[model samples]
Target: MTPTTEHRPQMSVEEFEELERHAPETVRLEFINGKVQVKAVTDGNHDQIVAWLQRLCMQHRPELWLYAERGMKVEAYRRGRARPDGVLAPFGFAKGHGDWSEAEGVLMTVEVTSHDADTHQRDRVEKPGGYAAAGIPVYLLVDREDRTVTVFSDPEDGRYRLQVNKPFGAVIDLPDPVNITLDTEPLEDLAT
Candidate 1:
């Protein structure tokens, strides 16, 4: 499980940034729903998958920019902000630090599950609902616990209407706006 340092009961964006700025380089944290949630320290295995996803996404569309560790700019309170494991933005969409990109136009947000139960819940439940509410077209979740990959699409009224899940080593087909099939073969080892 990821180590959590809950310094206070509720935190505003200002307070979250203050703590995040001074936090150690190794710490991975996100401001979600008035709470600051710490993520598990990333490992080499996790990093390898992230890097591979970036490269593979780029191959799918040279024009699109697939960014990692990009903070989701959600306008709603409490579930205000989230940092997706991988964020897909249109060509020239800002991915630079401090330049917040609105949730719209984000093609997809990927959440690779961690060992932490809190983090897992955040990924499986909180983030999907939040992303859908923001009208993001897609949410791809790599679930280590389930050893499967799920693609959520067609956001309608704060939820995804369609969800397709496939086990590792299978091909996950994405629909309109993002026409590509992601091969989950390489991710099989991470599931194990």
Candidate 2:
């Protein structure tokens, strides 16, 4: 379903803060291009990818803290609120605090693609730029149907210059912020 531009004014950091005070449980909102966009519920494939990534991160690197489907307010020259499918933060930053504001240093953020063309495009194209602008060093994308994981790194000029695409079973070296090596076998197994 296409989102309507109606209801409330264009999204701003201040406006989003106000809305957060009154946001309902059923409705999830994200700020995109100064607009509040509703996030759709994740499908099974999305859930699988998230789970696989989280599990792999935890098993390989127990020291790093990994968050799933949590709201992260990334402040760049332009402000935006994003909920990455998964985020890896350095250990001993801030534990037991669900608030992202307290957990400042983030190593990597991941997004799992859905069947929707718009969603896939946004995650693969727009979000990389946004995350890079926010100074997020690493961004991983898991494409379920394609059975591939794309790793984007070395953000420069609001974009990631390095793109590494690996099909199932390839080992991906997690970026500098976190020290860990993960294999894509588990993610590939999710397809079946």
Candidate 3:
């Protein structure tokens, strides 16, 4: 379920940013659904998956770059802040940006499920709402736990109108704005 902003936030956005800035390098922080969330550090396999996607993006869409751990202001009115595993945007998109960039011009936000208690809520639920609310075109979720790839697109009314899921070996086409087709066969060995 997409988290609702009905409840009061744990802290203001500025306060969250201050706490995040002082947080240790090992800890990644995100503010979503009016609450602060601790993001899990990427494991080796997770890093490999991101790198694999990075290579593919570079090859197929040379003008675009899959930026690793790029932070963005998500949710409606850009209230929530999230650091997606991979953020697909135009090359040099981060040139003049600070830690958190506006969601404008972002083609897609990618999240690879981590082995953590909140992975389901953070990656599958909250993120989709936040990204879609921000008008991001696509959200790609690589689920190591389920061994599947799910694509969320057609953002409308604070949610993705369409969702498509495929097993690791299947071919998945990331929809428009991020028009890259993926042969997820290479991801089979990297799921673990």
Candidate 4:
């Protein structure tokens, strides 16, 4: 079941930016539908998976830009901002370069599922729609408990049309824009 919403006070983009600027280094903040959310520190499994994936991606050197837990300000229709876990940019590009905004074109994005099912649903359902509307090519979800990875691609009509799910030890293939393969064995090992 997906997460339901509740009534919350809304803030503008400027207010959100102000909060982000004042936020402590350890506290990660994201804006969703004009509401600010503070992200928790990752667990051992989350950290391990992030590090392993980063290392694999670096070795491949697909010219794709990878960011971990970076703040991505994506444009949404009714909701103002939507940020994913990891955002993959086109090759040979760097985010937050001079005169660049977080709300830039993204090739792919990833989200690691949370313990809370509602949180998982938020990433799996809500963010995907926002990303698809933003024209992102691919979205990946890593379910730590389930030891599965889901790849969502082929966006049509402002939503993803194709979905691929693979378990641990499976070789996952990224889109052409990011031609890289990930072996889930290391991730599974880390989960243990």
Candidate 5:
């Protein structure tokens, strides 16, 4: 049997975008799992973690750029909007795109867990389903609480078929399409 769309978004994508645009600069908003979520302001360590990954991506794949907090239309049927910590795509892929760009050319989406109560549900659970459903090639999660990197890939039927996890200091291969290897040693330093 084919899959079905069980739930509708709390508001249309247009309404969400308009609301997001008018929000105060300090407040970040996201639509996920049919709810308008106030995304927590990232901490310094979170920013540094993204930066380290950005440098590594640029070093290994000069043809690609890791756009920070790049808004993306994600989830099945593009029902959700997320500003991933890092969005890896071909250089200049979003040159002319608006705030919410299609997930079409995104090679990978990364999220570094924040010190928020909602992080476990939002990042560890809901986000993987959303990114997989959007057909993104890979979802890389840097879990600060766990000090582990979990890579989710091979999306099918709105779920990733593969998942690999490694501790902070271990080497992790991000896989094809996003063929960058990470020596996660630096992550250990950033986890604090």
Candidate 6:
């Protein structure tokens, strides 16, 4: 038998898009698992880090496209959508707007850990499982709490089979989609 849609949203994707369209620019919200969650405000440091990563990714691969804080649908047991700091996909992926992109052909997703405890947990813990379940090849996590960048790759059975981490001052080597060594020396600790 063909596989069926295991997850269904409590609020339809159309409703989520409508809510986002009317919501204020400062307010960040996400339809996670079945409920709408008010996300934490993005700090200056977080913005800076995301900017730098996006720029670097663009420079490294001009053929591909990088989206900043783009929504993507990735879940196996619930209709959970996650908006990552940066999502690396093909050139034509932006054509599909105002809705969550299916997590296929997605190169990798970046998540810069924020200050809020809840947001931090969502990014560091919950999102990985969801992304992996959706067959996302790579999940890059920038943890400001410990000043480390962790790369989770090789998803199998809703979990990453490999994990590698580097401190803020070291060079982080990204495989596949972005086969380049990133200079993490420019990244500053948010605790300051």
List TM-scores for all candidates, in order: 0.86, 0.80, 0.96, 0.79, 0.95, 0.84
Which lDDT values do the candidates have, in the order given? 0.79, 0.73, 0.95, 0.68, 0.93, 0.79
Off by over 4 Å in 3: 1-6
lDDT for each residue of candidate 1 in 79-179, tens digit (9 for 90 to 100): 46777888887777763547346787789888888877686668887788888888888889888778899999999877899999999899998777777
Candidate 2 structure quality by residue, lDDT tens digits, 142-163: 8776888888888788788889
lDDT of 6 at 71: 85
What residue pairs are clashing in model 3? Answer: none
Residue ranges of candidate 6 with Cα displaced over 4 Å: 1-18, 189-191
Per-residue CA lDDT of model 5 for 101-129, tens digit only, reads 89999999999999889889889999999
Supply the TM-score for candidate 2: 0.80
- Residue 125 deviation, candidate 5, in Å? 0.8
Name the better of 2 and 5 by TM-score. 5
Candidate 2: where are CA atoms >4 Å away?
A: 1-9, 92-103
lDDT of candidate 3?
A: 0.95
The sequence of per-residue lDDT tens digits that candidate 3 reaches over residues 68-180 is 99989999899999999999999999998999999989999999999999999999999999999999999999999999999999999999999999999999999998898
Cα shift from native, residue 135, model 4 (Å): 1.4
lDDT tens digits, residues 1-192, model 4?
965555453677767777778879887666664467666657777777766776777778656556776556554543445446677765545534531235456767888766654565467666777667666788888877778888888876768888889998899998766677887877677654
User: What lDDT does model 4 reach?
Assistant: 0.68
Q: Clash pairs of candidate 6?
A: none
lDDT of 6 by residue, 28-57 (tens): 877766667677888899888888887887
Off by over 4 Å in 1: 1-9, 75-79, 95-99
Task: Please list all clashing residue pairs in model 5, or write none if there are none.
Answer: none
Residue 19, candidate 3: Cα error in Å is 0.4
Report the C-alpha displacement of residue 159, candidate 4, in angstroms.
Answer: 1.8
